[model samples]
Target chain A: MEASGEVRRFAHQQWPYEPNYKRVNGWQMHYVDEGVGNPVVLLHGNPAWGFLYRKFVKPLSAAGRRVIVPDMVGFGLSEKPVREQAHTLDGHIANLTGLLRQLDLRNATMVCHDWGGPTGLGFALSNSDRVRALVIMSTWAWPLPPAEFHKRIFPWRMMHAPLVGPYLLGHHNALAGRGMYLSVVDRKKFRAEAQSVYEGILPDPGSRLLTWTWPRWIPLDESARGLARFEWLERELRKSKFPTLLVWGREDEVFDHATFATRFKELLPHAEGPELVTGRHFLQEDSGEEIAGKINRFLDRIDGKQS
Target chain B: MTEIHVIENYTPEGKRRAFVLAEDRVGHYPEFREFFVRQFSLGANRLERPGYVRASSGMIYALVFIGRSGEPFPDGIEIYALPDALEPLNDSDVDADLWALLRWMIAGVGGEWRVEQLDATGRLYQLSVAANA
Candidate 1:
């Protein structure tokens, strides 16, 4: 995790792009592929990284779009696996399926959020014909129903207590300091130069052990432990017909688009929107340019280039 | 002797709701910490304290009904009592002796039970059972 030159001059003064490491499973995976066309890919979650899509990677890479975003091995400027079962969820979907098979990101367009909705729908339910579209936000694929206020939540049961989830996310980092200011709803857009590049790439406690093992791998039943891969990603995203959209945040306070946005519009019913804006739960720090102008009008109405 | 499932509902503007799902226990379940400290007195909300932490596998209550000054309990209701299972955190509202003390603590801890009700526009309702030992 060596980005110092004052963290590469504060990531070139807050993301100027042009950094792109690979080497997935041995760690060193930072990313930001930048402009071209047809590929989007931004996936971030938990105390954030991939610099939380640095404002949708330069306006969707100046509108021509080829954005890609990465940084997930242990978060931004990658490489921090001081073993906590090597931060599993099958080791972050095998480091984002080996960085989309070492960058052969075909078709694409998979922007996600919050544990990037089961690691970007478990890599689009195992590369469903190279996932052409799907925006989704807030997050949840399935299996989570048993709430009493998640055991009277205080540090979300101290991050699911296994020795106080490694002493408050590995010795007092407290989820990048107080769970990133209580998961933003604009706390003045988390200023101080984005909390100094998010508490300067995990400054201590053995690099916050993947934000203390990501809320104890939140699956919450069907006898957890990645609930059969999110119940096979809710039965293949309910027969995925692609072109999904769902962009929530109607006051999230932890994924409450009034209780999972009508179950993600009843499981992607010709998935278009659960849109409902005015944010919280880092709705990309309260609407990152109206979520990149609704992902450029959902990729120009799914390539019919909008009538 | 393991089985606990209590579910009840109402919300589409009506208000009143409930949830308690823990079944066939496995690793940690002291009868949901004695049915959530006897239906949420939780030792008088932890002796009027509101924010807490114990964790080794139990106690992390924070039912703060609002009071932010150096912040921690931002909204309200959060519990994570473990022995087998009992997890609650932010969705709010529950307490009508929480469904008769989760059916008298699953018949005073005597095995297999299921009671359901989830339909605030997401069906999966009623499935009662308690008489077993």
Candidate 2:
């Protein structure tokens, strides 16, 4: 699905970055490349594009690292594939891999959040030599026992219902509509313009095929398809020695720091602190500056070690 | 006398706040609400948000509401204006088409109903409704 003229104009005005695209994995993947040094690849999660890290690009790039933020296929300014079957965990991993290879990004620092953790880390684990450091936040790479949050499935369960899922997510845009609002700790920080862009990008049901399929992609049980892939990622993450930072949204209602973050630390025991920041699901909107500062400091420490 | 109360309602596909026009009669609101709901082809196509319903004469109407927020709002019909509902041909004609539609709705729910605009403070005023309208 091509972005509407109105949505394109609004995104350009708010982000003000040169829109770059590369045809990777049979789709036009959009990205923002800034600075000229060791590459720092930022990957955004479901229902959002590269715009989620708008605040991080300038600051991180200015600190002397090339910042590469991709919208991923089926999101942001990227061409959205209408088929539900086109969106899958492996498909997304391959999508990211294709983009990285096209850009030939190596020894790159990976910053991932939400669905990004799996997509970005999935790539990092496969090509360990290409990934220098890792910053993981508010996402899971492995399946977990159902928590209290997953049990309360009033609207969430309804969203995945056979007929209802398409109507709510694909049509009503339930996730894109109120998901961000409900996820954010500070409503004021979730600007109206940003909200408009998120909601506006996929205006129709066909455009929202990816958004609708994502929630169902959550591997809940034994029959889940991504179970083996996630298990592989978890095993690889535990053994990997790349300097890793676990930055978590302390107040996140979805992926609570207490549950997911703790699990992440246990896996990557050698990884740096699970530095709890004040924010929610989409923490970048709430604490982008704070997170960026922590990341810059982490990078500085790594650079100092290399020097 | 038919008095219309405006309330703010939530919609994902449409605008955040809709111009909810409710009638004064208690028992008569369901009928009033149903009359307008029949106009738009909503549901599955749009959860709670109503899109423009084209008329036999090729005229388009944005009477897009049928749900309630549990708020103590006297229910009627919701008419979305500007940006989404009716794309006004020009800036100067923004209110013209809307007022004309409101007149049509008022005429449908017939009576010597005097229209008054409800403000944010719950204070009412004769802001848009003309004495002749």
Top candidate (TM-score): 2
lDDT of 1 by residue, B11-87 (tens): 12221222222111111233444444444444456335332222222222222233235423221233322221333
On a 0 to 100 scale, what is the lDDT of residue A151 in model 2?
38
Docking class of 2: incorrect
> Candidate 1: where are CA atoms >4 Å away?
A1-10, A13-15, A18-36, A51-65, A68-108, A111-114, A117-119, A122-159, A174-217, A220-232, A241-307, B1-133
For model 2, residues A1-307, the per-residue Cα lDDT tens digits are 2344332333366588887777788887888899988999988887988878888988898999899999878877888886565788999999999999999998899999877888999999998878899999888888753245643334453344333344445545657756776778777657565777788878876777677567667766676667788888889888889898988887887788898888888998888989988788898878888999899999999999999
Looking at model 2, the pairs that clash are none
Candidates, DockQ: 0.03, 0.02
Worst 10 residues of 2 chain A by lDDT: A1-10
